[model samples]
Target: MAKRRKAKQRESRAPRFWGQHAVLAALENPARTIRKLWATHDAIAGIDVPPDLQVEMAGVADLGRLVPQDAPHQGLVIEVEPLADIAIEDLLAGAGDGRPLVILDQVTDPHNAGAIMRSALAFDALGLVTQDRHAPPESGALAKAASGALEILPWCRVVNLARALDQIAEAGFWRIGLAGEADMDLADALGGKRIALILGAEGAGLRPNVASHCDALARLPISDRIESLNVSNAAAIALYAAQNSQESR
Candidate 1:
């Protein structure tokens, strides 16, 4: 009796997470079992929720009670576990048709990372590659920023980024790093059977060795007035350019 009572208590105390990515992912994935859903009035519109699933309609403050203080839940939260990671070998082997990949070099900001994931999905990117230590963990802010893209795209974290770039190069990818001060524009430098768009930290840019690993460096054709564009925005533009270039070729 005590054991059963303790289990019930633990179940009740479990918190729900919010953000479109987190909620929508839970809904889409059959393996992700949802305990309860707390949604804002505006967010819950035009959805047929399962009758058995627990539903709570509440405002931001009520939603805040479920997650950490800093979580940007955006008025929707669903309790769930983390997704599994895919092996590098599998991802590379599947890169058979020579689709483009976006390699993230130490861009750890969750909002930025999440936004990149969203863009990657939008352009049908192969996958997002990030260094394990430097990448952001899956969280509410990331999920919120992803806006449901976190579920579809595979975010792979590797130990050695340089070696990973080498593997990518050996696999027939023309690695192009996005730099503000590069001599060539992005469209001019995109030449290959497969392309890996390498992006680095916002202010710091790509590391020297990482840049050297790439076959070429390219700059976005943007205003000379501004020094740089936001990292995620730059990624979206680069992905779009790469996909377009691939299609043209």
Candidate 2:
């Protein structure tokens, strides 16, 4: 039917994920829709895919042609639709006491976002919030960097990050902006039952508007030997610090 043709057209243009983690995660996520899957014989042997789903057997070279150059597909590639969007309200509604939130401002790089997602999942953070216009779309590079975190993490894209921060505050989250210029330390800012950790894009740092929305601004305790840590690394450290702070109390 016409609907099936349109669906096929959408799948043709949709993103293709490769690698064992990314492909397998996509397959495992019920929210994900896999259109076309191709895998090498050796790779397929270890995978227990749905019996009803048609899978194409391919060689390593054939799978290589499906993804970006030198992407390390690990003998798998699959066409898929982007996961459905999550509303910020729903994200906040799901937050529990002591669970942290990671909010990104203008962090456009997919690698950093992916790594942050990985950290958020590792720390059991409530969710990730980002400006809809400033964040990268789901892609193979991101999924690869996240190591499967992208499929499971609750991600919220909003029109205005500052406005979203206000909603976050109204929901009883004490917002802490990670600003190198702030005199406050991250540990001191973790006073509330729930914490909302905000980070910004590298180089530019937090915008004035977003910074204004924060309840307090805190910086990581890093030596001057390095100007600053990578956003993802900083997020991991901060999340770890938050966890320790919560557990010690």
Candidate 3:
């Protein structure tokens, strides 16, 4: 009996996911394969969850047993496998009406990336492009910051960002590099056929090669009083500018 109990214990020790939005989105998505679910009686009562999915009604400690002690599961936890990453070529091919795409050049911070993703989705941008090596691994913090958008947005990790920009240009995207020192303002750089808003790390801004790859260098029209806007905020402003310009025409 002890051996059987130990076997059951091993089965229960799986990676559990939390966050109401994350779990609910996962549950609603038919493509998402959920392994197990643990929720308090009150929390489960709130949702019209499917009957076929495995469920357990338990206390907070029961959820503690499923996930890390530090996790803020908010009365529920779900164990699921990671979804597959999307391809850049497929994303470009699938572009319906030439919406803008945002490219990250070694912007490694997960919080910044996730925040940028949230903004991207809000502006109805095409998708995101990042280097696989420099970017952060997908985790709870990023997912939380994205507010359920991390799952929906297509983050295309490519081998080289500059090379990817070259591909994007060939695919008919006009690359616009955002740099503080740039002579051209963002609005002046607008009216392009298709824009790839290329950005880089905050202090360093866009690298020389990365800047060289872009068709034009543009700056946000802000006073020189501040050093610079946060990279994610810059991205938001740029995306907004792009959309606003497109709508005006």
Candidate 4:
């Protein structure tokens, strides 16, 4: 009976969002369906709890048991259903501002993916694209890393990344894959056209097949002494470069 109960808990689909930013962001987003809210007395005092939502008052030690070990919950945690998936076609249809889009090629690290989302929002990118089978799902750590951008950014998970690249190309995006070994620098390769900045997982870099789908491959102007930038940092630099390039045009 205990084993069965533990299995059920492990299989639960509801995502628990911890940390002040993650919890507060979800509370404010109208589209987020919050199932339960647990907070310390002091934490609850500052929050404007929704009248219709269920809330539980708990002590700090009690709250610790509810989240992963060593997680900094900041005295709040929330159980919520995953956000509804946005269709790639819908994202393409709504792409009018010429904002660049980011496509992650098997970036499975939740923290990295979340940080990329934060950068995407900071640079006014259209959205983030990941393969449905290889991407990290919305989770507490990811949400915490995103620090509220997860609620604002549109994330589209597609089945076949190569096929999606074809569709994005059909919509007139100039896809540029970032590779450490690429001959051209990012700035030299970018134009005024709408762009899709493609980044690969750390260490492995962009797969050959994915690179083949891009309009061009470019590299950051980093020194050879350091091999590569962390995926999230690289993303921030790429976005900054793209924004500057667009404004200069």
Candidate 5:
């Protein structure tokens, strides 16, 4: 009885996804379990609702109150259970196609993480990895920034990033840590190996232990005038470089 009550409470507190793209994506994802949906008539129009799902129609003004004051909810909101966590081992085992992977170390910003996921999807990367303790959970801001990529991208959160790096290395992936101070250009470092691009937070790049775990440290070729690129921008460029490099060989 106690366990059941606790489970019910937890379910009640699940994240509410808003915005047209976020809510629509969640609705389309068969794996996503939607608890409730609220939308203005205009917002719900053209969006196919599941037959068994519960929905409520409300005014745009009322819909605005459901999310952050500044959030662009687009009159649609959904209460959904978070996606189940994926195993790093499962990701590696299914790496026969040689798709690259992205690993984020202590990237706590939801917007940055979401943008990275968008880039990962754009480049057809296998998945993304982050330290469970340091990463952000599913949120409306993240989903909005991702623009629907969040629903498609497989995200894995692990206990120890260094240990996860070790497993990635053992899986025949050439782990390349990105740092502004690195000598080798990202393109030069890529010798057509199945790559796992490791990135860190904005100001402080990869930590010592994380950098040590990587097979090589590489940098993007940019002007020395700027300190460093935003993590998401760096990720997009790296994915493009990796894809182009592999195709050229």
Candidate 6:
């Protein structure tokens, strides 16, 4: 009964998801709970909204007010319960030559995390893992930045990232940490092994202990055009390189 009440409370405070990408993605996810929806008539014209969900017709202005200021709602917004927490063991269990995993260390910015989620899905990653306390919570901005990947991708949060790394290693993953200061290039770090790519927040880079947990540290072969790439961009590049390496092998 207490758990049921907690679930009710959680459902009541569902995050508002705006923009067509975020809203449609949430709608399509079987695991996602749609609490309330406010959308322009045109936004629902061609879309098939769930019969059980209550959708409130509204004007563009009404939709705008439902989300953050100046947020591009794209004429739709929906209050949705965040997906259930995913277990790291579940991710590791599928760690066989399946998609590589991307782990973030202290990537607290929702936008960066969302973009990394987007990239992870694009490159067919197994899942994204983040340290629970150092990661961002589910939010409209994050959903928007993910561009629907939030709904499709498996995102796991763990209390102990170092311990999770140990489990990943035991699952036969070749953990590679991406650092700008690393000596070896990212390509050199890749082989025929199932990869677990680790990226840290921009500027700060990987935490010392987190870097030590990885099997190898690699740097992207970017020229002196810029000092470093954003964490999200770096994630995309690393994922692509890892996936490409697998295909060749």
Model 3 scores a TM of 0.84
Please report the candidate that would top lDDT against the real structure: 4
Query: Over the stretch 130-224, how does candidate 5's per-residue lDDT look in tens digits?
Result: 99779877888889888888888877778999999999989889999999999999988897679999999999899999999999999999998
Off by over 4 Å in 1: 1-16, 31-36, 39-60, 68-75
Clashing pairs in 5: none
Candidate 2 vs candidate 4: the lDDT winner is: 4
Estimate candidate 1's alpha-carbon lDDT, on a 0 to 1 scale: 0.80
Error of 3 at 155 (Å): 1.7
Reference-based lDDT, each prediction: 0.80, 0.86, 0.79, 0.90, 0.87, 0.87
Q: How do the residues 1-249 of candidate 2 rate in per-residue lDDT, one tens digit apiece?
A: 000111212123789888999999999987778888998888888688988777999998888888888899999898888877777887888776678999999998988999999999999888899987789888888899899999888888889999999999998888989999889889888884688899999989999999999999999988999899999999999999888877888
Candidate 1, run of 10 with poorest lDDT: 1-10
lDDT of 2: 0.86
41 Cα displacement, candidate 4 (Å): 0.9
True lDDT of residue 184, candidate 2: 85
Error of 4 at 31 (Å): 1.0
Judging by lDDT, tell me the better candidate of 1 and 6.
6
lDDT of 3 at 75: 84
Candidate 2 wrong stretches, greater than 4 Å: 1-12
TM-score of each: 0.83, 0.93, 0.84, 0.94, 0.94, 0.94
Which parts of model 6 have CA positions greater than 4 angstroms off? 1-12
- For residues 78-116, write the lDDT of model 3, one tens digit per residue: 876555556677778866586899999889887798899
